[model samples]
Target: MKVIGINGSARKGWNTQSLVMKALDGAASMGAETELINLYSEPLKGCLECFACKRKGNKTGGICAIRDNMRPILEKAHEADAVIVGSPNFFGYPSAMTRAFIERFLYPLSSYMMKDGQHVRLLGDRVIPAGMIFTMNADPKSYEMMNYQATLGATTANLQYVLGYAEQYNSYMTLQFKDYSAMNANMFDGDQRVYRHETQFPIDERKCFEMGRRLVAKAKELNQ
Candidate 1:
């Protein structure tokens, strides 16, 4: 079994990447060969909206027709038994890199054919388990206040519609700095935020690892 983890964070060794790595480690422990891809290192562009994938006589076979660095990564995702995608929430949604990658990855595999007067997916009936990890500086309560839940819910629904099943894990109130004094301290309740980071971050990491293991287990079960 093979599982692939993709990190959409621009920073190396940051919260999102660390969580994705832990998930990959969990999958590896389950006897699944796992690989991690950092999008910061790749030159990925958003979908061109050329509709080439929807055109007749297209030869790409459900793969994005774009010629870019993300093509190979998308191919890997298409072939992998499972995929773990991580992105830091930006402006109530995924970062630009993550959103672009997902658009390019999913658009090609989708179809606009009408079935019973409703559009239907033309992608193959393959079931690929996927997990999404979202990291943010706000707490769960603040997430709803920021209206991030709607964005996350839509993204998860799209993934489940295209891929057979999808799950999400969120890490809230992430620590952005080692020293709160380094940034604008007046804007935040530094004491409470720092305390949560010091106390809860480790628990969130454990949850990421377990999510990875569970993702692989479900993939294995489905593949069997």
Candidate 2:
């Protein structure tokens, strides 16, 4: 089975890419064919508030009126057995790149479910198994983007239960740190330091790699 990854980080190969690559590698190790797609580089944006999918005849048939790059991604997205979406939490929510893709992908599907007066399980068996990874830079006591998880849950549920695309299990990883040790006199922000006491790279590269591997494992389980 082929698994697909959509990286939603604007920083190209930053935390998002690193995390997604790990998941891809884990999937590869399990003999699952996989591909990673970068959403930021793709030409697309959030829903235009255009009700074309819901207002027009595209409902139930799962057609998006917006004929753009999203069309191709939608085609590719459906071809996969599993999808892993990774994004860095931005401004108390997912990045714009991720939000844009989700809108198009779920709009038609959800409209079909809601537009009709029936409580029909439009999602039924059409939904694939999906996983999500969210990363952020926040300290333990800080509520940085803490509310994002709820928003994600609501969106995922609507997409999974209403649109019937996939089951959504999620993983969360964050870095709590400060470049200036003066921020925390002890240089201790709940056990982990922002930078290695003496490493060339300050970030936790190992954690990133391990997370990738775990994602792939989950993908394999879902595919199987």
Candidate 3:
């Protein structure tokens, strides 16, 4: 089995990257193939609403038509057996890089639906199981306090609803450090402000390792 992990943290060796790597490590240990895509390094574009994908009788769903950086990653994500995305919270949501990546996912499935006589909910539950990792500044308690409802929940919640293949969720956080100075001292020497923030500065290093291993276990549990 193969799985892909995406790091949307924008900074290398920071909280989001570390966590996504960790999860991939776990998947690797289980003999499952995996790869991590760095969002910042990729050139992704925003949705132009060209409607070429939605055009009737077009089987490709406008996926191949959009000329942007997200095309390759989106293709791999759809083909993988399990996929995971790791993003740091920015204004209570995944960073802009990550958000843009999520939008690209709409293309392929939309195309599958428009294809010639293939009808079964293109992105339906049985397609492939997926998961997400929110490497934010908040603690698990925050999600509990909110009753599992919070702004950071927008992406995962939407994916689960739309794709119905969401199989697991894992998190690693560094809470309460909101500024660059604090984050530099705690997480990545101030260079990773994109990942460092108040309420969550540095993720627990051990947890990073554990979260990754858990992903591998999860894949086995679900698929086997």
Using lDDT as the measure, which candidate wins?
A: 1
Q: Model 3: which ten-residue window has the lowest total lDDT?
A: 196-205
Order of candidate numbers by lDDT, starting with the best: 1, 3, 2
lDDT of each: 0.85, 0.60, 0.64
- lDDT per residue for candidate 3 within 99-208, as digits (tens), equals 88777674445433434675446554444445677765445776566544456676776666545555434453443344557434564444444453433333443454
lDDT of 2 by residue, 1-224 (tens): 67778888876666677667766675666677888899977668677767776764444355456778777776666666666677776765678888888777767666444435765443445545565666665442344346655765665665556433443333333433434454654534533533332241223344444544554455455444
How do all the candidates rank in terms of TM-score, highest first?
1, 3, 2
Q: Candidate 3, which segments miss by more than 4 Å at Cα?
A: 61-64, 107-120, 140-148, 167-224
Candidate 1 lDDT, 17-69, residue by residue in tens: 99999999889889999999999896678899999998888887778888889
**Top candidate when judged by TM-score against the true structure:** 1
- Candidate 2 local Cα displacement, residue 196, angstroms: 6.8
TM-scores, all candidates, are: 0.93, 0.69, 0.70
Candidate 1: stretches off by over 4 Å: 115-123
